[model samples]
Target: VSVCAEAFNPDDDDEEDTEPRVVYPKSDDQRARLQEACKDILLFKNLDQEQLYQILDAMFERKVEPTEHVIDQDDDGDNFYVIERGTYDIYVNKDGKPLLVGKYDNHGSFGELALMYNTPRAATIVATTEGALWGLDRGTFRRIIVKNNAKKRRTFETFIESVPLLKSLELSERMKIADVIGERSYQDNELIISQGDQADCFFIVESGEVKIMIKSKTQADQQEKTEVEIARCTKGQYFGELALVTNKPRAASAYAVGDVKCLVMDIQAFERLLGPCMDIMKRNIVNYEEQLVSLFGTSLDLENPGI
Candidate 1:
């Protein structure tokens, strides 16, 4: 069921609670199944192996009989559940009438929306058949998932704010960008993108530097193309957008200058979040072309003219 967000009120008492962490006993089979189920979840994608194991350890198993109301709409969220076996139906209370909105049977999960946003449970989940589920308590979910996600958002937001290209975006829009973008690290001299490849994503340097290069075929019969370094993108600078914006092949190759980390957003996100800045980006393309002319003196073979 679809639900909207509400302001999260962090409980002052929960902040200071020193109660020992709760860990439920699980058989080896149960642990293995939970691990497999969690592997494909977006919420757990950023978690390291150790953190993943911690989540597994904290989950308890619950067996439900047919017609059991596992979660009720409008109640405060307490546990997030991962389906292990059998079928369930999701119901939403619309205008005092219960409507069946969806169903889950496989390894699907629910109740996290409430926990993550501090809203009431928006849907009621009822067991259609006897089923088993692994549940993680509210405190554990916040400690592991909420805490790490907040830290990551703050880190990405800081780098995004430093980018001149995105300065025109509102704070809320920038925060939305931060939420969907992802991070990747590259070793020294690792190729981030190759010249002439189709552009699918844009990059923003989070740390270290990215070396920009362009390839040129000096002679008609030459089999090898000469690659020349054009620029170095330091922290907060961005690359790989020219091709994406122009809908052409990458104009230059990007390589990690050292141990480097970058924030990446796919073409879809670039168009969605940065759509308003298109005119600004188009203007900057001309400025980039001028810079290239000054650097080479003669025109380089930039079929698409981008970086």
Candidate 2:
């Protein structure tokens, strides 16, 4: 199955509410260890506390003796395994010989590729030392992970639609943006962007407000510059596009006004997905400059673009 967001249709209903999830009760000691191990794994990072508990409950432990073959190459895979204890060697059959390619010690995960792609196991896993492994069935994994991912994509799609800067973009382009964008949260008074920093990722306010500040010279004789608030961006409003477009250092700073949440798009995604709309974005700068002139009574120097 394709892992891309678009590959999983949003219309497909999540079975989470209806399906009876399998549970393997664990002792408090076991739960603590699993929680610590899961925290370091990238696969579980996106899941919330409740979803994480569901995963922990679904996992069953398997004890293995030293030199035992845990999984054989080319065998049909049904469950994904995470190491709880001991070491294991990964061998891929190259020609007729078993080639030692990788190893997992103490904490790691495997057997996911087979379940994810619905293919035969690519390698053989042999226990190098006596250990235990946590196993999760494919059904539960897909129901929780795959379905939740689809839900997230749908949420992002809906939110991205409200961003005025992206209104002119085609539907396909907007969907691509939704796939690449990520979320970031900031506390009140937290600095989001610093003046003179190189342009990297731009942002759209998802909640609360962001204050755009610029350093301006009040007079030719002034020894120090004064930071003035230029704009306040609320939900659906975007900033930092100008510097990204001009390939210049940020000419202004931005800070969270209250508890704030933002959707972030890095420079790479901006260049790749929004590249075709460069002319449209450039034209929009005129309106931006006009707004600045009206609001601040002075315009920003385009040679050093601001957010």
Candidate 3:
């Protein structure tokens, strides 16, 4: 059975009614499976059980027979797919022929990038066996997922306002910076930045601590590396400002001292949203440099330790 977006979307007329609205239903096992699937997807990673349920409420079941095209390259995409039970071949065109490019089995998802940005589908996905899937449309994703992300970004914006690097920014400017920031989780002992890696992003500790390490001389060989802990970063502190201006290799490494979460912004977004702050960084660079050297030392890291 196959259906399009218009069929599963909640009726708009029910939203404003005084009566209590009943969300779409799912079985306990179905909800559990959906929640597990949502975790691997960055867009819905932060959703709580209720939010996950809301997504399930908006989604509808789809089934496909062997050799069916779930999505075709170059199509205007408005719906995202989450395969529940299936094996599939994903393809892309090369020299006017569809070339095998990827595969999707149970728990796989596709069409999300297009739904997120309303872009053309990048490849074709065809089922290799009988399959079951769930689909979410652009309207539902925008209404629920987009709004939820917006609210979360607003809270993060408020948090960044406390940083001296951005303290002077107006609420509007801070929000601009906040909107593009992405979230990542690090387990204990995970390296968040590595020494000598080209710096491309800045990070702010949102929760837990990240340890700063500097590379120092070791007994084995002058060329060999040893990490020496120098400082600890707690909530509200940000790093990598030197990279923002110098465009040099990072001088130190940072690792999650324990379970940690951070908000990150890549170089382009950093420059585009906070370009005016370059002047601020320049004036404060010396003081910030002094602080880091006094704390983390000169030789060190770029990437957070490990994946």
Candidate 1's residue-wise lDDT over 22-137, tens digit each?
Answer: 78888888888887776545566677887787888999889999999999999988998888887998898888999986677665677876787777887899999998888999
**What TM-score fits each model?**
0.57, 0.52, 0.50
Top model number, lDDT: 1
Q: Report the candidate with higher TM-score, 1 versus 2.
A: 1
lDDT of 2: 0.77
- lDDT score of residue 87 within candidate 2: 95
Clashes of 2: 0
> How would you encode candidate 2's per-residue C-alpha lDDT over 70-160 as one tens digit per residue?
9999887778888888999989899899999767778767776566445688789999999998889877777676566556668888888
lDDT per residue as tens, model 3, 57-97: 77767889999988898887767777788898878899999
lDDT scores for all predictions? 0.79, 0.77, 0.69
In candidate 3 the C-alpha lDDT for residue 169 amounts to 79
Alpha carbon deviation, residue 243, candidate 3 (Å): 2.0
Ranking by TM-score: 1, 2, 3
Ranking by lDDT: 1, 2, 3
Say which prediction, candidate 1 or candidate 2, comes out ahead on lDDT: 1
lDDT of 1 at 214: 82
